[model samples]
Target chain A: MDEPLLRIVDVWKSYEDLQVLKGVSFELAERDVKVIFGPSGSGKSTLLRCINMLNPPDSGEIYLRGDNITAPNVDLNAIRTRIGMVFQHFNLFAHLKAIDNVSIGLRRVKGLEKQEARRKALEALNRVRLAEWADHYPAQLSGGQQQRVGIARALAMEPDVILFDEPTSALDPELIGEVLQAMLDIAKAGTTMVVVTHEMGFARAVASEMIFLDDGVVIERGTPEHFSVSPKSKRVKRFLNQLDVLYGSHEKLLKLSEEEEGK
Target chain B: MLFQTELEFIGMGIVNSIIIFPISIYIMRWYSKKKDMPHIQLWDTSLKTAYKVSLVWLMVNILIGILFNTFAKNITIYFLIQYYVYMIIDLFIGTIVVKSIYKKELGESFMFVFIIQVILFGIGLIIGFITVLLLGYIFPEVSDVFFFVLEFGLFFTLLITASSLLIGFAIGISLAIMRVYGGKELHWLSSGYEKLFRGIPLLVLIFIFAFGFPGLFWYLESLDRLLASVIMALGLRSGAYQSQIFRGAILSVNPGQMEAARSVGMNKIQAFRHVVLPQALRLAVPGWSNEYAVVIKDSSFASAIGTFEMTFIAYIWGLRSVELFTLSMGVVAVLYFLFTFPVTRLFGERQTKKLKKLGMGGG
Candidate 1:
């Protein structure tokens, strides 16, 4: 009933023979951490990409704070600048250094001066605890470091909402924690984000609302406690069984499950 | 049995060849190493290192022939045949040595080096026949035009290669973008332009421009149509190839890169300019250098249109003394090789270093 920062309605997308996304819809409120999870071929990444018009939904109306961004002749670049995306591959420009990777869009798209962009980029990098690696190229950095750089790049945009397309998926098992920590810090800062990830701990801790998407449809969407305790759909209950192993039945997760059960 | 004279001749030539190698390859490596050469990144492996070893072998043989006059005491038919036979054996042995040392990357191109050797030997045979078998029949006036054409010819050949490559490279890059990223009409236009220019021979193009087009312009008598037509015809043909080089280079850039840039809010063109083109240009270096060699070689066809370039100079010298035609052509080919070989090798080295800096191997 409250106003939403970003809203999508009945999106459909097909690539040649593949109907990658069906009638999908969602909404993001300001300062909301909405975590979406699904198995492979669930179209989670495609849906995130569509929100920023990177994939440009074949049929859907996307409204940003009330203005319809999906209209035929909208300024896609302006709309995109307000919606940052972090990729699964961490798509940091290989040729540019970490700081430059964060600063370039500020300079180019945001029309910030060199010093201003550098300051903001450094601030963002510091936010991710990667200020020291500012001069290092993406290729020179490790997987987790690169993913942190990717997050810093997104944060530098200061977009209305950030889209995380499995940002930690490419990191080594040991490396995923640092990226998650950086992401958790960003989430605590109250930047609206729509994350598509398998990190169930992140969802339980940071996500105000959690969703289960399967075959491009939202099977379940609720507060983390509600979703965990009841998980209305049978598919979700079955899917939650597989995910608990991935979520690592650690102490924090065990505590979370207990809290949700009590709720 | 190797004679002291033949051995000394080649041995001094080897020393000379050593000096020449640095001048050609090192300078080239230094000059070309900085540019974003498309896929010209060479793997700095022992296999590719053999390119230097084998080049040394090939150059020494050419040097032996050039310095042959000092060892020209016996000019019998059997002697010339024996010298060629031994030279062939040395080249073959050199190939084996290179093979034994490394064979991964160099093996395929090593065959091309062998084919060049065969072509060189064929040229040597023709030169031998003209100078030794038909020496008495050659007119003395042939020497009169030799120094003049050789001096002026080298200068103009360099000028033509520089001008044509500069113009072609610029135009080719534009055309490549059109074919790669342009709308349907521009894509069709670029492809059509590439096909039209590439399908027609440079000789035919020069003739069309030089003989056919000069009638339209009033001030043509003052301008150097020979130079103009040679550059225009060759430059246009080169643009077609350059476009392909750039197109391939642009394609080599990962698609994710453009998507990443676009996700950051830069439009299609900005994403291409910022993210894709830099990587693509690096990938294009090898292809760019090949196109460079092709342009220089094609510049030889300028002689057919009377451009007074090196080959045309060689043609004039040949006609002056018909028997010396192959000898004159050999002189031009040696110079052509001198000009072309270093450029390709230097640019090749630079590409590898650049690729390495980008955290990729000289692949």
Candidate 2:
């Protein structure tokens, strides 16, 4: 096997007395899509956040291309420049237009020139199919449009990996499809990604590997086929069954997955 | 039978009437302009009114001068008319110049006209001095401290206002930062500083810093008397109000903003500088403008410590010539309004525009 692009080992995290991620371990090959799914408070989001040191694990080791990012000697800023995270809330700068929001971090953090950063930001926005809305403020844009801008902002960095923390979770149902379609395009373009989402259909379609977590622990890990059809753990089976009922038809769920993959 | 007053009293009353009537009209015209009356209309009407009123007053003064001369002693209506005409002309020219400059462009032009008026008025003083030199050949005991105080008083007020704002902004921003992001002890200290200074009346704070703090800092035995005390009091008191303005602006920033900045690889300081503080400061403008107006007005308290500020000089002149009190106070009031009123209005208008842009204004 090729060397993993990212490696997490023995990661432990807590918020005060409440332990959120318990001794989790994971690895990702270059350009892999890894989807983590669980019910709320299952620490799936916490795990993705820890990878970029947004919530630094209490005791853990995180390595990016064999460099120990969790070690004190490593420059977290240099590490962060290569890793981008998209938030559930679409945290675009309210004062800035979409293009400016994308360009600012590139200019300030990566030290890109104004014209060069702006050009790159426009390219990223175009890639997300939001080129027309570049001049619009976050307040002016729809939720889906804002999320696309958030993705464009992250992509402008040309990060080695993108972390998505429930990206479409905050969107209206009709708007969620647009954001998810953007994510599907990103996955097809072979950007390494770690996404924490409850979108089971999205998980089954794009993810090269699926992790099912419960109670701050990874309860099941397998390919989409295994998790969807004959999940070995009772928790996995029960979760998929509940989703099957909510979504109405297993065939519809399969079609949704196929549509995302075809995209 | 109706005029029972003594000849000297009647002459003084005529002099007082000549000074008071024109000044009152000037003030009323100024107030009307400030209320945003059309500049052309304001100028045209006030000029006509001043011309009519001054004509009637000049005639009355001449009649009084002749009558008083015939009854009690010899009097010179010539010198009094010369003085009155020069002043009315100066006031007319100053008003027109300032109003025209104000109408041309808002900020720097108005300030330029105001400064030119001061210089031209100073030249008027030079004319007075030369006239005094000519008159001293006849009357050697004439005093001129009153004119000296009037000129210096305007300059001193501008100086105090500028210093208060500069020093206030500096201390205020620093204290605001400490209050927002400092460690536990520093935050408490900043909060305590704001609370203590803002709670007490500005005059009380000035008194304490001027009279009381010196005893505490007496070991530093080289402090200048008025300068040290006034600067200390004004800076500290204005800093307290400024900090609150800053803190409120900072709080008004959305929480998601900080999180977004942090997620973009900025540390706390970088996030604040790049993402947070810029927006926060924009929000702070209206509040800071109010604080600025307060600082300008409160700087009058410097007079209590004998700082030779505008109000203090006005007081000195008022005490010497009781009639000059109303005139001097009016001058000080005009100066204060001139300093703060436009800035307040500009900030208020800008704030309204910002709200409209944000789509947060009324639907």
Best by the DockQ measure: 1
Sequence-dependent TM-score of model 2: 0.68
What is the per-residue lDDT of model 2 for residues A82-129, given as tens digits with 9 covering 90 to 100?
898899998788778899999988898888898999999999999899
Model 2, range B1-363, lDDT digits (tens) per residue?
Answer: 312223323333333334344454456557767887667464545444443444444444444444544574444545445444644554455445545643433243333333433343345455555754675555332223333333445444445665666787788888889988889998999899888887888777667876776664565433345555666677777888888888877877877788778777777788899888877787878777887788778778878777766688777766767666776676667666755786587676667578557533232
Share of native interface contacts recovered by each model: 0.65, 0.40
Clash pairs (backbone) in predicted model 2: none
Q: How well is candidate 2 docked (DockQ)?
A: 0.29
Clashes of 1: 12
Residues A127-161 of candidate 1 have per-residue lDDT tens digits of 99999999998878999999999888889999999
Q: Which candidate is the best by TM-score?
A: 1
RMSD to the true structure for each prediction, in A, is 13.8, 13.9
Q: Rate the local accuracy (lDDT) of all candidates.
A: 0.77, 0.73
